[model samples]
Target chain A: MLESIMHWWEKKQYRIAPYLFISPFYILFAIFMVYPICFGIYLSLHEWSGIGEMAYVGLENYLNLFKDGDFYLAFSNTLWYMGASLIVNLVFSLILAVLLNSALVKCKKLFRTIYFIPIVTSVVAAAIVFTLFYDRDYGLFNLLFVAMGGKPLDWLGDTSLSKFAVIGLIAWRWVGFNMVYFLAGLQSIPKSLYEAALVDGANSLQCFLKITIPLLRPVILFVMVTTLIGSIQIFDEPYVLTGGGPADSSMSVVIYLFRTGMEYLNLGYAAAIGFVLFGMTFVLSWIQLNLMGAFERKE
Target chain B: MKRTLLLILVALMIMVVVGSSGAGAQEEVTISMWTHDNLYVEFFTRRGEEWAALHPEYKMNFKFTQIPYDQLWPKILTTLAAGTGVPDLIGIEISAFSRFMKGDIAEQALVDLTPLIGEEKEKFLRWEPYMHNGKIYGVESALCPVVFYYRKTAFDEVGVSTPMETWEEFTQAGSKLKEKDRYIAAIESSGDTPHHFLALYYQQDGAIFNSKGELMAEDDPRAIQALQFLQEGVREGILWPTSSYFDAPHFAALKEGRVVGNYMADWWSVYYQKPQLPEQAGEWRIQLLPAWEEGGRRSSTAGGTGFAITKYSKNPELVFDFLHYTYMTKENQIKRFLELQYFPTMIEAITDPQITEFSDPYYGDQKVGKVFSEAALQIPVQWQSPYWSEAIQILYKEAITPVVADKKTPEQGLKDAISKIRALMK
Candidate 1:
């Protein structure tokens, strides 16, 4: 084996072949990906605005994290949003997917495209469109509410309702994509199982629970894990809509971190906040996997 | 060999012909100017036409962009950071000049215009704010000192006299209008809102960020007191509660004579209120802000941009010429400001007969020139540091607006803002 390895190394053609083939990825990755990430981490260790001399602060930035109450508020809000989106978006998507899967449904592709249109649309554009719908006095929703004798709400202004407004936006934008996943999962289930359930005097609900859900477990787990990650990183909608305002009531961890790093120029504290967010997400994902028996299913 | 020789001979002849043609031709230089709005394009084009008539050898190309105010600074900073493909001339906000000074990008990017100042220095009376380390880096386009424009009808109804001098009297008079179901003022607490909070802070002898770039006003008693004053209005339901600036409600309310007063720089007069309200004309009059203390300052300057030549400019002399022609000349500056309502920084134009004699139909025949000039002279010159933008955001977000909304206690809010400022300063 040693002699063959030595002979292979001696082969100039083979030696140059692998290097030439793989060099592009390594070179590009080093320059684009690895360098910036490492530089960002390094930047987090110092006190430098986008301009000026950087002062070496050691671990003071990380220490300041414990005292930063805004971080805690943002972190807690992130968890709250994740929980809300997971439950509401998942249930809505699952129910919609089931409804569309029924034989009673017509124009399947057209409906699918219509439902999927918002998901494909840019978040900035979608947020602007939703802003018009959520406007206070003259908005469509408020007009309808007023016609029904209900008072209009300051949708983006009131602290109590601001988070829900953002969650509503996120759910509306995302539920269709989740439904597509659920629909695909439902389609993969063989119709024979449902037919058998029907022959056994089982109702539609019974068939859904006993047969459809068990087989679609893998897809369900996939969606949950991805959604968990996505929800934790929520930024654009809240940033564009409320600007984390009405007194930072709707600020997310990513937005807070962005403010610290970019706007405030406190990269070190921002990095610490970033690490804390990373740890929380990682632990939560692990808990989810274990609780859902995801590992056991895969094994 | 013969065919190759013949080809070489033909190429040599072609090269000789091209060289002779190029030698006699003047070298045409194209200068790229990055500006915010296309509003200035016609002005610059008109100036370019004048410049070409004087000097036929050079061509000037203008590139104007209207980036969102929030986006413009960061984009410019990033381009400056990369040290490539930047415009030959750029405009920097007076409020944001300090931030650019702190960054290595602008230090190398800007041309030192000190030598160019000469007698033209008098053209800009408020030049100290845009200067750093005794070197002028930028030239002011407009003198944007803030003034109050009140509804004459509302004031008359409320029985308030012209030019209320003290904050107490101003607040008292504005409060009476509330009984008649009118807003005392349109309080804009929106994101990146500019009410010249820095000027207010300065008038009360408060500073946002100190020389060391640490937040100075966070723990200061005066800052908290200033915030509480605005909060009182909200609690009393005298000020508009919404966060948007000049939103539909604000506009509609003002149009219907429900808004008692509004505060903005001269730009608002030209760009918004005057141009939009032709029928409601002549019911508005301008005055300086009410003083906090009896002997305290009244006017605060808010927003303006200065033109600067980038180091990459090929013809720095020609760039200076354009700046002089548009900015320094009294005739051109006065024409532009009078036509555009930009409020020229030129001292000569401040008291020009054309300006003083002119009566705005929108302001009900009230003379605006004297009011603006008095306000401009009364403006408190504050240092525009690089950290001013960060300080403004913190002060507004954590202290001013939050206090106004009753979300945080004044002291607590200031503490949070100061602590954030301290962390940022590090």
Candidate 2:
């Protein structure tokens, strides 16, 4: 083994081969990621309101963040949105994947494609479609609701209901995508384990509980981590739908950061918000991992 | 590897040689101008060629960016912050011109065109927002005054005679019009724009900022009265559902005889009374905004924009001359008024035979030019300081939008707005 390793190291291309393979990622990362992040942190220390001399505010922006009531409202809204969406999406996708995995499901490819259509559709186009869907007066949704003896719900306008409307949209677009992942994990489960459980006179549901779920632990962890990260960075849907109002009821943390940096032209304050958002995301994700681990071990 | 490196080096050397070779050559000075309207691109492109013909030695380099008014302020501010490659000429709105004027942002970043164009201060009327410390910074380009456009058929159907002057009569007529299965007015909602509240407040003797530049909307009785009028209008079912006025259906609704009147600025006449609505062409009439206190004080803001030379411009002289020729010149002003239906800012354009001679087929050959010109002169000028945008946004968002949404009472909303704005001012 030592002689073979020496032979491998003696190969002519060994010195440059690894670096040549990784150079693309390194170059792109340096240009796009590393430089911007360093510059953004530097920008956070100064008071630059899009004009004139840059006053050295140091930690003033972070201090101001403590008092900004709007930031708190936005923070709570983001948490509520993420919490609600995660619960809804996970349950719905898992149920969907299980149902699709069953033998009764016909033309599975066609059904999958139909379900996946919304995921691939342009966000702006979907937003416009949802705008019509949420329209109070002449909307098809209200028409159906009114026919069923229900009052016409102002889905997009009402501050309380607006988040649900946006979440419904998020779930609509992402459920199929997440379902595919779950389905792959389900397929990857060892068939003999389920068969052996069945040999012990266990039912299909029992076998799934006893073996399938335990096998799908790694997949669930991957999905949970990814979805959590994606949901926390939610910007476009809330931005296009509500514009952070009817009194900021739907203002996500990212939307607030955008308004600070772009609209209010306070880049330093925006950067401070960015760091706070990063901390929140990291802490919440760690908690999610711990909870998921507890659930995994129980199974 | 050496050959490849040599090739890359040779290319770089050639590019540098080509770039520096033109340094000692006759320099071409390009003036960058940013405009919000897409129509400006067409207007400037044509004018640029003409200007270029007049001065062959200096190329008239034009840079146009279409930024809508809502997003213009933030984009301008952010671009300015980048501290590189800003448009030398930016089309500043009358509403937002003060924001730049307040801080040394414009003062430091823009050229003092006073020395070059200061001799002709009297040539323009009312220069508060565009000038700082008695120095001319911007040029007046367009006039935007609020005008009342009512459906003639709706008026005749309601048996209301031409031109109701008093607020009570206006309200009564609006109520009467609503009674005939017609909406009283298709006014823009306060939630979207609270500046209408300020306009209505001013019409009712309310002032936004007090003598010491303190925001006084909350305790100001006039603001309360104005909000009451809006609330009353909503209560009386005179106002239609909140919808986009610019949408073609809104115009079609007017033509199909749904809505009676719309309180809109003169700029709207271009889109509203057009060949597309030839059937309703002869049935529309323009009138002055209804007096808030029964003809007690028929005064509001003199609305329009003035052009300014940015301090960052390498060619201030060229930009000032462009403004003078295109906007300030009586001949070009009349030409624009005739072509684009813009109410010219020049005082002489008001009385010029060119304006009086024009007839718009859209308004059934009504002398639109003469009407707008008269209204432009009578418009009351207001204090436009640098803090106006921040103040207005605060007032609109905190006070006006909340009241309109019924989140808070008009009094409570205005009070909140005042308190919030006071904090920002400090």
Candidate 3:
């Protein structure tokens, strides 16, 4: 009887094994992600302070989110940062990769390692170091500017200028990481394409534009999308360096959501803010892809 | 083979029962206390070993867990919401203390600390902050009364005496002192204007909330005047602006003779000046914060923390036992002040003859304890509502920060903060 039961169990296991293997991920996702998102959506229609009774508030939270000037300010800041970083990152990382890949540049491995160092460094540490650099008085940047006959500028303290300072910090950390991808894309392209261009009397610039740019388009698009996604969730650099201050000039959308949810404990309103950001991200990503012709066939 | 498997299993089961029953005799009741204060953790961990030795019969174990100051509130909120994983005791920041006191203490997921205060509860200074109705929910172990920290060397060079008797004298001194490239003080930029604003607002008996927990800051002449004073200081170039009070630039300014005064708590006397500005060791002195007018209220609290026991605690009595030994006992409170530099909250500890008599070399041989003790008594009792955290942020973001940055006039900033806070209450 035992032998029969064991044999029967093994046969049943063969039928159900694949589902059982995949169930853990789906179960965890349902619990952690799906449940929270749904609950958050439910919470968006109520007012709760965690310890107090949650009072139902209907669509008021979303209405208030639309009216909040701070929300619009933070949203604009995040978009500006995302756009500026995409252009600077893609252009600069491509330049760095091309220069490092050139024949005249020796010790490429050592140079690449040095460039990649900031990618692995902690964001908080880099933000702190950059804060020292950007100090209005007695900082390296200001002193250097003064030495070169320019008046010292308040880099992180001025509302108009703080967004750019945050952008510069993001560039310092992510430029090398983007270059590594471009380097891989450059390496994978057959040398024959470049050689053929050279044989056709094309100069280095001509070869770069014709062979590199057109072929590296896919990698550039990937870099742009990933950078945009990362930008949508940016928090630490400004949080550490400027604290989103000098008058909330560097406050990103996600940081505003965080302050609402964690600091203020307006979970319902914070949930509405989060979903609005989610909608914005989805539409923005969609528009970005269409503009970049990501879905177009290879030419 | 099957019989052998059964016999091995039976033997393992018998071993498990005996071992489990034997281990029950030595099981220790570990009480976890969470705090954001790192110095307190190191002190408590050492003291806990002593506490455990004295209570060997109970088989007690004490554990101290430190959380970051900002994250502690959310951690408590989540654990309480989930109804599990709450530590036995938590150090509640004074800013966050009011939010945890829902109707009754039990409904609020806090153990009523009424029994802990016992018969002599009147002696706990600033104890009003952690109590509700007739019951107390927590007790502070430190008095964080603000005092004026000034540079004696800078004042002497400018031909001024110690402790400008009033703000008018302080400002007059600043104009004269600037010839030597010195400012009277550094009003921390828009970023930290609220803290200084609070100290000044308290000088004139301004309260953020009335006794019945209503928003009351609109058109308060004291608050507006206090904000205007700070803005005027910045505009006159008497108050240098740093990103915040304790940032790198601020420290550099404090270390050198760039700025002279800091209106901060007594703890900063040791924590900030002793280590950060050691060169100004004997050149520094403590004076009561200069009054808004002659003989006005002299001192107020900026920030501090207190201890609260969680309702989820399996042994609330035992947790309070440990807290009482550490905080309520007169000898331990005095010991904490004498050794660890944590200023006392207990009235007896604050006025301990030993504490007042000990001379601090850092402050030019000033009896630091005696000076601060008198200042602590002058701290006016002000009621705080749960909306205080929200109100303070609005004051910073809408009023003080914008005013300092010149984005808004001082009057306009104050009006905006009032309107915004009014909207929040709705």
| Pairwise lDDT winner, candidates 1 and 3 | 3
* CAPRI-style quality class for the chain A–B interface of candidate 1: acceptable
**Could you tell me the lDDT of residue B194 within candidate 3?**
63
Ranking by DockQ: 3, 1, 2
State interface RMSD in Å for all models. 3.2, 3.9, 2.8
User: Each candidate's lDDT (Cα)?
Assistant: 0.75, 0.71, 0.81
User: Number of the top candidate by lDDT?
Assistant: 3
Q: Residues B1-426, candidate 2, lDDT per residue (tens digit)? A: 999999999999999988867553535778777777665566566666777777766645677677776677776776676767777787777766765654457677677767876666666555655766666667756666566777777888879886767667778887888878788676444233454566677555566754345565667778887766666676687765442344443555666677777665565666455644667777788777777655465434434566667766777778777766777778877877776776776788777878866777766677767666666676654555556655665665566555655667788877887887777666
Pairs that collide in candidate 1 are B98-B385, B98-B386, B99-B386, B282-B362, B282-B364
lDDT per residue (tens digit) for residues A27-143 in model 3: 999999999999999999998877657889899999998788888989999988888988889989999999888888999999799889999999988887898899887578999
TM-scores for all predictions: 0.85, 0.84, 0.91
Better structure of 2 and 3 per TM-score: 3
lDDT digits (tens) for residues A223-298 of candidate 1: 8988899989889889987877666778899989887665555556777677777778899899998888977854
Listed in order, the DockQ scores are 0.32, 0.24, 0.38
Q: How well is each residue in B272-318 modelled by candidate 3, as lDDT tens digits?
A: 77778777788888888878888787787777777888888998887
